[model samples]
Target: MGSRIWKSIAFVAPLSGLALLMGFGEQIDEGACSGTLAFEKSRQLLEERPEVLDIAPGSFRWEGDCRFAMQGYADVATAGAPSRRTFELLVALEPRSHRWQEVSFSMGD
Candidate 1:
């Protein structure tokens, strides 16, 4: 009985360890998306554009490893007037510097 229990533990131990490692990796990826770095980088890039007047608080979602998508409402300049519109930003982490970079941006109704 003791030998059988030992075998079971030996089989389960590596699997549990692997699961924990994977979970930890996922948490890190989520943090990168939800944390300030990704959002701030995206906001900065958007604000730099002349048509983007202002940006509101937005939500961030993980796209994949080191990539994030941010969506929110923005005040965009149209016909020399500011209009509220929805915007989306795709950002990715720079592997060399670990900084977020704007991949793409779009604004729509």
Candidate 2:
């Protein structure tokens, strides 16, 4: 009797938790991936690094919770030099509990 009751609770507990999750649609704090988010972040980066003239983020897709992929190019203007280039871009970004941060990136690859 004890074993049977324990088994029933084990099976029902997970199902109940899943039901609660599905009940509150999109209530979880886990962020979502979207082009707007990517574009805004890129714009913020440009502001943070004034040396960068522009970073036009073209497209974005979610890789997972660990990061979202951002595809874009950067136009850089140094103290006495300015250059603009477009190339294949791949970048990884991690979302913290409060904000997102760039982890790794590459261009022309």
Candidate 3:
């Protein structure tokens, strides 16, 4: 009797926790990769040129209570008008620390 009640409580506790997470999940901005950089505006070029291959090279800092700074570069490669190739990049970072993990990406568009 008591054991069955405890088992039901254990199952209900995790379900409620998952429901809370679904209700208050973080909002992730599309195509935004932040790292440990001083100025975030510097990387605005990443959104401008989506057709080119983007290479993001950067690192992130971790503190005990979720304060950090991140920065990096986004490289874009595109074909030129006269059989030439062009490379464009945006380097950016934020002043305040955000709770995020560093990831390595090798995807192209």
Best by TM-score: 1
lDDT value, candidate 1, whole model: 0.82
Output the TM-score of candidate 1.
Answer: 0.61
Q: Candidate 1 or 2, higher TM-score?
A: 1
- Count of steric clashes across candidates, in order: 0, 0, 8
C-alpha TM-score for every candidate: 0.61, 0.48, 0.29
Error of 2 at 102 (Å): 1.7
lDDT of 1 by residue, 30-106 (tens): 33434577777887888898887888857888788778788999998888668999988999987778778888888
Write model 3 residue lDDT over 5-78, tens digit each, in one string: 99999999999999999888986775354343422332333344465354353654433232333334444544
Overall local distance difference test of candidate 3: 0.44
* Full candidate order by TM-score, most accurate first: 1, 2, 3
Quote the lDDT for 34 in model 2: 53
- Among residues 3 or more apart in sequence or in different chains, the pairs in candidate 1 whose N, CA or C atoms overlap within 3 Å are none
The deviation in Å at residue 6 for candidate 3 is 0.5
In model 1, which regions exceed 4 Å deviation? 1-34
